[model samples]
Target: MTGMRILAVAGGYPGWRAQALRALAAGWPPDAVTWTESDALPASAAGQMTLDYAPAPPAQTCAVAEPAAPVPAAPVRISRDFAALLQHAALYRSTQRWALLYRALWRWQNGDRSVASAADHDGARLHAMAKAVRRARHDMIAYVRFQQRAGGGMPEYLAWYEPGHDVLASAAEHFARRMGKSSWWIGTPHGSALWDGQAMHLSGLPADPAAMPATADQVEPLWLAYYQSIFNPARLNEAALVQHMPVRFWKGLPEGPLIPAMIAQARAGARRVGQAAAVGEMPGKPVPMEAGRAQPPRALPSTLDQCRRCELWRHATQAVPGCGPQGARIMLVGEQPGDQEDLAGQPFIGPAGQVLDDALRRAELARETVYLTNAVKHFKWVARGKRRMHKTPGQREVEACAAWLEEEIARVKPRVIVALGATALRAVLRRAAALQDHLDAPVLRGDALVMATYHPSYALRVQGVRTPAQVAAHIAETLARARQLAEATLPA
Candidate 1:
């Protein structure tokens, strides 16, 4: 241990520090190397290596009459996934994080190829620490509320945050990208980041929280008023609200204090609405059908529009019903409608639908020959500015809408059903199951052959990692397999 060399770094620069790790691993034994980013190094350290933040000097090569045989470089292999994890874990506050990452990397470089598995203790520890760092970065980005200076020169904004990890440097990039051409400063317990319209600078020393303004801004009241208006009395989930926006962040947020009062008002308003409904004096237009009552049979799409089985109907414009031949051999069930589908009152009409259409064409399956429907009838969404972003429906909501789906299934009587995503898979199976488990494989559920496949929307979400053509190929393959299964189940 006394013979080992120590490498001192300025912490938070994982990429530069990684170069040192690679150099050490290629030169010395793992046990004979010590990496430190602390303020002071051990007194007994035999040798020292300092990692400079600035660009390094170009290497100078000198000719030697008898060049010593180059020491064989130790085999060091790191996967892109593991490298990303190590970079994230470097921001963790744990003192042993550097050692842990090195040990994992060493094991990976050695014969142990399973070093990246979560089942391995070191790998699991690294993942957990990386997860914490990632969460802290997310929290910093979400909770850091910038307040404008009273008498601003070039319009400066300031915010004070207390992140659980060393994430100020990592999270600063997000603010820089989001608030382009605007100057802002975010101070944390560990450090501070300053953005000046053009560039971002990170200071290693902690900034005094007192420097931030404590007074409320003029826009806060308007924000609170808007929050109150949008706070749905019908859906009051305090536990969920607190989980997403933790109590620890309440101090920094402007609408924090108003939450309690808003919840109270929401409860009271819900009670009033309940009382009004009980007396048949509803707040809005009365729903044609009673809540939770079994819907009556009507062989028309207009009747499905009058459904009130779930709260989804209250928010969505209309119920998006299945379309195609009534007795088609194949039925494709998607999770739910999107903004386009909700507006059009039809299934598979959004960007996801376009992808599905392309895949169907590639699979040689005629669009008119197959039935298209959704597991859930209505489009569930949360408003973001003017956009209605899609929201996954809860299991309870899925169950509530199951009756309509069952009606469609009975009407269609398709020999083969394709569940397009986890939500649709759960709906069709009547039990929770992973999409990967049944993909491209048919499972006979009584008389119908049910197959699972990635949803078109999922392909859209993963398009950055996987090309659109690749995703379409996968969807096409799944559909082709489903068509073959359908034909096999048909009467010979």
Candidate 2:
């Protein structure tokens, strides 16, 4: 094998590395041979028609030739960074890729460390190719849409793809870990990868058209509808969208056909709200009514500070417990803690706190004498923009925190319990007691007299029945009435 030797490699790095090692040991320089893929043959190069050695083993080492006098094989050392770059570049499809890799390897082995750096001409191309392969890997992961198999055979899911590089084997691992134990098949023009629960196998098999439907279960239609509904013509940036998701991939997506029409409509409508109908008009899943829930594994934790009765504790800063003299004569029960109250771990210290202080002053009642607490201990809120806005607690949450309110009431033993709002009214009497209807009356619960009124925070907002100032005046009068009742009806 002397003049113009042709080196045929199976595929990529492993196959070439084994053959390259034998070529190097036989004293073949990079320019001495023309490298070609096993399936491709070049008719332009003239040669003596000499051939390279047979296929080598998968191990990244040179195969020893059985010469009359066997020569010892020497180890070639390379940096870890260079080794990784070479592997990534192998995924790039090119006719002269083998020769370029061999030239870099030979130069590195001969003590030119700069050959692998980007400053060198060959290094720049290597890095660019590696970057393209990396982007292609990401594209495959993001774009592959798996459809449920028609017959539910060995592979439960099926997806067809067309990636620019040879990355099916590498990208398949991502789906394997995500879909765990659920078999899947991802077929491509280059090859196919089948995950059969335990392991993944690679082959040249094409995808079966019968097994894959255009729309995979009912999910595709729902997904397309959602994508179309949320696509605001007012915010669409066509250039940026195409840059991120290339036009080549649109053919495979379920919503692909709708994109062109959507763009055309947006252009015609001049980016207005009239192009698409309101989201409320589109069909959506109805909220479940009185959905039953499983009882927690155990009752509330031993202490109120560590209570896990509901998920409210997960996001709250801390539980705001009732604070006042243990045996106060009057107990004021509000809805729940606000933002500032949650952080301080004490009751009545937010916007509602200011309103309460004004009411106490107007009523000629001291704040220290009245016990302060809430029906729910933790803060309930949902995020809006950068701030945490308040949200009303659900009936289930109210039920979970009932025990805490019960303990507080028993400990205080108040003669008069003022229910600040409907939440406190229901939690105290353990029933649906409307605040508007019972505002001027007093009801009995256990040993205490329960009175209903607007919560202190109600003074901060406009009301249909009263102004903020009017609401504040009414609260003061309610508190004064409760105080008189407490003074008159005392236990011996």
Candidate 3:
């Protein structure tokens, strides 16, 4: 019989007749017959068979049935003398023959005339071959790739690639369990894996490309939409994208629709980026100076009133403005809005202020003798259940609150300013200094001497770890020195 020969291959367990294989078979000669097996076969004509025609089976074991008679079980026959001898032996011949033989012949090339070595070698080889076959079969199932196609009101993936192993059955089950209602197909050079939303099936490869289904319509469009949305024009890396998502994947994606638009945007974006870099490289123009360089008058006030900017105004009973005689010798600055300060709307009324007040009393300084105000005018807090927890204001918030502090500074015009911790230091001086660098040391801001020290809250938190009494004594000593400086510089 003369006809175009066709070979069908598959992975995992076989399924019903392959639809693609049947479609491809229609145009072939009448004498052609399909043979399904777990072996790879090459295309060849009887007379024109070439070197490629001799295809070896894939490195896998196949369960094939050939008509043959079943062998009957035979009874074991043993001599009474041999049986008695074996019973008294240290090792049984059935389980421990190899051990017995090895022990019996320990000499060099000990020619003990028994088929034991040959039998053992054969057994070992058989075991290895079986293991290889099983592994190859498994790999064949796992590595197959399938293309997606649309049919019967559902979308599916259908493509053919020669799998190097048997991984399809498990792969199908994984997807089936995860997406129970979805239908998909995986076609391998050997076979195809099909999931009809309920169960999976494996079958033979098709001969013709036309027999395969068309590409899915919805898949391409959805893919392209997602790709475009995530394409970040600001950081579009063409090389990186191509490296991660290769050209091969583009054929299966909606990338074609976005390619031209992306290219145009990328070029424009690159030019703008370059221009900005050039501008940044150029030196900034200097502004003309007006006056000591002319000093603006400070609009300092002695009391908190008519203050409204943040949400703090809504909750705080009153605005806790600065308190002190105008032109007081010493000015003290602190963080804003303690619980009591928020309620009283006054600075130096909270526990830390109470601590300061007590320290001042012990140091023999009058409570109303020095300038007292917060670095920030308003309270900044976040809601936590029923309580409002204080949140440090951001840089912009600090800048907004600076006007009130500046007013206080203008009114007081003290000879010395005492910044209580990092926050106070930044608010008063308009710059942040490292605690380690400026602790105990004062930074001069124009004519005013700015002294730095730990905030009362820091001392309070570490009370158990270190003695609060010692901390209070240290603060008193710093204040005493500040008082002396104030008296010497602005004797009142």
Cα lDDT for residue 483, candidate 2: 89
Candidate 2 Cα misplacement greater than 4 A, ranges: 42-47, 53-73, 205-216, 270-492
Please report the candidate that would top lDDT against the real structure. 2
Q: Write down the lDDT of every candidate, Cα atoms only.
A: 0.77, 0.82, 0.56
Weakest 10 consecutive residues, lDDT, candidate 3? 101-110
Best by TM-score: 2
Report how far off residue 456 is in candidate 1 (Å): 54
- The whole-model C-alpha lDDT of candidate 2 against the native structure comes to 0.82
* Residue-by-residue lDDT tens digits, candidate 1, 1-492: 223444455655454355455444344444545567657566644334322222332323111112232323655557899888878888888667767777776676656767687788988888898888898889988889988865676438888889999888878999899999999888887788999999888898879977755445766755664565456655678899988989899988888888877679767777566455456633666568775574555443347765666689778777788999988989999999998777667789789999999999988999999999999998899999999999999998898778888888888898999999899999998998988888866787767889888889887777466776676788899898878877874543
Pairs of residues at least 3 apart in sequence or in different chains that clash in candidate 2: none
Pairs in clash, predicted candidate 1: none
Q: Where does candidate 3 stray beyond 4 Å?
A: 1-311, 463-465, 490-492
TM match of model 2 to true structure: 0.52
TM-score of candidate 1 against the unseen true structure: 0.48
Query: Please, what are the lDDT tens digits per residue for candidate 3 over residues 178-292?
Result: 6576776665444566688877776755434356576655444444534654554556667886665444444433465476577687687754664664576689787777865
